[model samples]
Target: MQQPGTVDEVWPSHAPENYQCPFCDMASGEFAFPDNLCEPGDLVYSDELVLAFIASHGFDPEPGHVLVTPREHFELLYELPDDVAARLMIVTRDMAVAIKRAWHPDGVTTRQHNEPAGSQHVWHYHQHVLPRWNNDGLYFTPKRPIVDPAVRARKAAELRAVLEGGPTRH
Candidate 1:
């Protein structure tokens, strides 16, 4: 596993001109985001500005991890508009609370990566809201493979139910 502060060696230093941003396509509903288990309709929460869904990649420590992103594609933190960033943060916080209530994990973590050197595999800006437990070894272990799509869709539905039920308290 790559250290928290170090870049992944294979990550590109610059965005290639031909690089088709998956997030943009996902936002446009061009297709299901490649490798993601949840479809656009499976989003747990969405508004005019943001969307939240269960992540395809599962951290070994937690299976029902969630990702929150702007409806508009922002490739990096620097490129994100202030208003969208603020809205995304709010959604991230709300999703963290909902994840905690729905999954009942010991704790919760929210993470965002900037560029290749920051260990950002995806070019689009997003926040990962993960459930955590003691000694889960998140930074020390490799991320688990994508969970089964049916399972992910079910997880997304569960989270969506929680989110729809009412407001979440920290």
Candidate 2:
């Protein structure tokens, strides 16, 4: 399917000059950037097309928030090819299930942002899979401090184990 919009006209990139995309780095098995909060052990799932990992920043009382992103760089949702967008959505659904199985949250939510006005700091396209509970106030509360790597790793492991040998899709 054609992209819904004229990407060039509707979605301008926000990346800075000489931008080193952290998600691309993580997908390629590199996480050495000093500014990047993601770590090697934070990855929970991967395939030829996408990667899913525990986010470095999370809401209070819920630290295992997940991000599903395309292996290739796509600055905004309007830029994704149909196949990449399909795979991204599939992985997003799988990550949400994994979160439910691992964390047993009262509920779950997924969100994607496109531009600066939409609060998308990262230029790459990604979907957030967050565990939700009643009265959690996820939208109002600020993200908690950068989570410790060890905790993130553990959370990743939990979801990784749950997803291992779980599904195979192309």
Candidate 3:
């Protein structure tokens, strides 16, 4: 399939940015919400196959990025069963439509699991609905630049709260 608009010039994926696994001295909490793990629940449901979180931390590729993720620890998409796949597809498609209907993005991208070679870090199965816009940004967006050191620390703390499903933040 055609690669959706990439932030290649700006936002590149961290090779081995394995939030799932961390090297020594860094500590496991360091990897907490390492990358784009923030999402607010515009809508959500938990079934046998998957659980989803509406993207909370979003800008440039704007706020509508939806994450459809499996509940069980299925390493890859191939690991998903026919029934799960069917349900995932339904949710994925619905989110795509929802992004279009709600955000009116220039385009919508449904990026699924990628591996070490393809830059997959998290072993569990997941898909991302990144809403795209003209000049929303490629690599690092102007609106969503790399968080400053303090801000990054603060953001991680904020997401720690959200990821842990604790208090809400903005």
Winning candidate number (TM-score): 2
For residues 67-165, what per-residue lDDT tens digits would candidate 2 score against the true structure?
Answer: 999999998887776688889999999998888898999989999998888899888899999999888888666678999999999998777765563
TM-score of 3: 0.53
Return the lDDT, model 2, position 31. Answer: 78
Give the higher-TM-score candidate: 2 or 3.
Answer: 2
The root-mean-square deviation over C-alpha atoms between each candidate and the true structure, in angstroms, is: 16.5, 15.0, 18.0
**Which residue runs of candidate 2 sit more than 4 Å off their true CA positions?**
1-3, 6-11, 140-170
Error in Å for residue 110 of model 1: 0.5
- Local accuracy of candidate 3 as per-residue lDDT tens digits, 1-170: 22222212233334344445221111122334454343333336556666565755465535656778765555566456556777888988887887789878888777775667765665556788888877666433346566679978987778666556532221
Flag regions of model 3 displaced more than 4 Å. 1-43, 56-61, 137-170
TM-score of each: 0.67, 0.76, 0.53
CA shift at 44, candidate 1, in angstroms?
1.4
Instruction: Report, for every candidate in turn, its global Cα lDDT versus the true structure.
Output: 0.74, 0.84, 0.59
Residue 38, candidate 3: alpha-carbon lDDT: 39
Could you tally the backbone clashes for each prediction?
0, 0, 12
- From the highest lDDT down, the ranking of the candidates is 2, 1, 3
Best model number under lDDT? 2
